[model samples]
Target: MFIDVLKNIVITIVTVLIFISAVEIMVPSNKMKKYVNFVLGLILISVILSPIVKFLSNGDKEIVNSIKSYEEIFTDNQNKFKSDNVSTLKNNGKEDTKKELFIRNFNKNCEDLLKNKFKEMTFKSELECDVDFNNITFNIKKLRIGIADSKVNKIKKVRINKEKTDNKEENEEYSEVVNYISNQLDIPKEKIEIYKLEE
Candidate 1:
């Protein structure tokens, strides 16, 4: 019985060696070849140790159970990683939406305030702001005001030996508008710009 068992083991090993050689010849020489070789090495080791392991444990079910448990752990970890990435993306989208809403509301409020203060003139406003997401702070960088339409008439004054400039009244109006915006919005005068829109 011992001699027969030895012969069977020798035949099994020689068959496995021949199969491994055939597989190696068929596999391409590339990055994937190393991975294939590693898997085949593991199979070879397991086959060589099968008899000793069966003698000690008396069954193959324990090995299969251990492999199944490892697979379960790997799948659980992969699922957790994917969920974490999805949640991070959602949070980033929410933050971007919040910033857009804040900017839109701020511009609307400024335009409304100017409209109420200067009843005779129509104003359009644009604002540049620096936003800090970490601290949730907004810093006003610059404000641009465009005079879309004006109903105020230019006052003409008679002067002795004075050359009249066509844009003098418009310049004065721009200065006044700039000063008003600077004071009301608590922005620096230099940081505010006022321009008349072309008709």
Candidate 2:
């Protein structure tokens, strides 16, 4: 935790200094001041970038570590899922067939409705979906909107519209939809908005 905090502080300070130096370079200034600032900027940048260079040069150590952790989890889950699927396939063949049919139909309808809906907006850079099975609610999170960094004009937009439905079939339908959006948009799960709905 301490290391994480230190890393964040270092990144923040380096980012600020880089931005300041960039501005100093762009704006016209005295020759002496400009040269001095440029030299100092180079030194500061070297100091700031050294750790990052070392970190990256270690052959992506952190990324490999994260991948290994994910691999372990996925392997465990795959084994459990395979066993459960085998048992389910044996015990409830009819139910499994019915569920598949419903899922297919539901997905077709959703595709027809959501096609080309998100392309009209400019400020809304990305879209995400969230579903809560326990509470039977579906939610969406739109990024680059209502945030100062994104410069979105909230007043121009009326409101965010969401669809709600009730029933196990509808929940299954939403599950397919949310999963589709998550994959297609390349958005992270943490960035997705989650809400509770009837179904």
Candidate 3:
């Protein structure tokens, strides 16, 4: 009980400091250094308390475990992002055109993969795919679609969408989506496969 009170007190103090910093920045003060100090102080307080905030917010052990599982999904998705097929596809100057083609092709492949290739998908309640869109060499960044919410359906399903960029981050957002689904649904990482468009 004491620990909780202390944490709340610290959080409240940090929140007040942020508000004060914003107010200080808006005020017509000749002391620019003081304003900067206030802003920096606010940032420092937030940096220190962010983890605490997350801990406080995730009061449930199950939720926290689910988040860990979600992280694993993200890790696996990243491994798939680095696959040869993904690397082979490049996004050049004509990104938009390639994106359209990739999406069309990806959707077709997903339908086929679910129906003919990986029949297990239709049996599951979730489907997701991620695409990278800004690969200037192939003109693709990332694309992803997935079932974001499923607590009501009593079914766990995800549809991932992503766009790959020229930078390594192109596939990162897609990984985030997968991680999010895994975390939200409390699904184990082993149960989810990184959905990719076959080259």
> Model 2: how far is 103 from its true place, Å?
30
State the TM-score for model 1. 0.53
Error of 3 at 175 (Å): 14
By TM-score: ranked, best first: 1, 2, 3
User: How many steric overlaps does candidate 3 have?
Assistant: 52
Q: In model 1, what are the clashing residue pairs, if there are any? A: none
Off by over 4 Å in 1: 1-51, 55-67, 152-173
lDDT of 3 at 126: 29
True lDDT of residue 199, candidate 1: 58
Better of 1 and 3 by TM-score: 1
Model 1 per-residue lDDT tens digits across residues 24-95: 999999999999999999989988998777646853565566668788999999999999999999988888
For candidate 3, the lDDT comes to 0.51
Candidate 3 root-mean-square deviation in Å: 30.3
Clashing pairs in 2: 137-197
Q: Per lDDT, what order, best first?
A: 1, 2, 3
Q: Top lDDT: which candidate number? A: 1
User: What TM-score fits each model?
Assistant: 0.53, 0.30, 0.19
Q: For candidate 2, lDDT tens digit of each residue in 116-154?
A: 443332221233344454476545554212111223333
Question: Which stretch of 10 consecutive residues in model 3 shows the poorest summed lDDT?
Answer: 142-151
